[model samples]
Target: MEEFTQQAGPFTDAQQWWIEKIADATAATETDFAPKLLEGFPFSARGGTFGFLHDFGREAAINLLDELRRALA
Candidate 1:
């Protein structure tokens, strides 16, 4: 996702922390947290869902991810 890549370097460091918070919070409120959110994603949007990520709307990020997947495929 363009927005995701721009917001977080990788889901490696601070970005990982950012998304972990959302996962943590979601888990506290819902039992089906990670699975529900991660079911069909490209595995790169996690960082953005947390505070570690910034500025990416869903469409831009999905589009970017789709393009990247297409290229890789």
Candidate 2:
């Protein structure tokens, strides 16, 4: 399972884009979501097929979406 669980962040990257769109549409800028996204990491290290940061970003995106859903609900 771990072998198949390659680190991936493109999904997270795209997710953040949508979130930004929503924020723009609503004129909202929540610091919570405003983490130096690509901070502390190189561009090449972000959307790889395997890495701890990638996995972390994926999980973070999931949680962020969930929060958005609940808030909107």
Candidate 3:
């Protein structure tokens, strides 16, 4: 994920600090039935695949935060 961090460019600034939020979300959401999904989020890919994986996590973070943000807002 660190590798992706470096390449996330414009998004890097937006998401760089979101890592903790993402992680917390992952932990909370995965604490029950979805635990496996968050535990072994494999990142073993290359090139385009890596990019997708990178974006996957970021998008996932955003997706998970959607409801949280809305509720808070």
Candidate 4:
């Protein structure tokens, strides 16, 4: 995941900091679920796929929060 992030660029500063939030969300959501999904796949694929989803979902959710914060501000 870190390797992919390095190649992609852009999320290397403040945005990169938000990754903790994403990781937390992923851990909470997948703790029980990913095992089911990964049952037949290669063991190494787990981290990559989990990270991909975390980065995607966290960015999306934060984008949504922009409006809420604006309205509440």
Best by lDDT: 1
How high is the CA lDDT of each candidate model? Answer: 0.42, 0.41, 0.41, 0.41
* Span of 10 residues, lowest total lDDT, candidate 4: 32-41
lDDT of 4 by residue, 1-71 (tens): 35534544457344364443434444556532232332233322435444444644666534523432333
lDDT of 3 at 45: 23
TM accuracy, model 2: 0.30
The candidates, ranked best first by TM-score, are 4, 1, 2, 3
If scored against the real structure, what TM-score would every candidate get?
Answer: 0.31, 0.30, 0.26, 0.32
- Model 4: number of clashes? 0
lDDT of 1 by residue, 1-73 (tens): 3354455445456544534443454545554333234433433444334322243346644553444344323
Q: lDDT for model 3, on a 0 to 1 scale? A: 0.41
Tell me the tens digit of each residue's lDDT in model 3 across 1-73.
3444444444554344444344455556653223223333331222233333455475665453453344322
Candidate 4 deviant stretches above 4 angstroms: 10-12, 31-73
Q: 47 in model 1: Cα distance from truth in Å?
A: 14
Candidate 2 residues lying further than 4 Å off, grouped into runs, are 1-17, 23-56
- Tens-place lDDT digits, model 2, residues 34-61: 3344333332244422332354457765
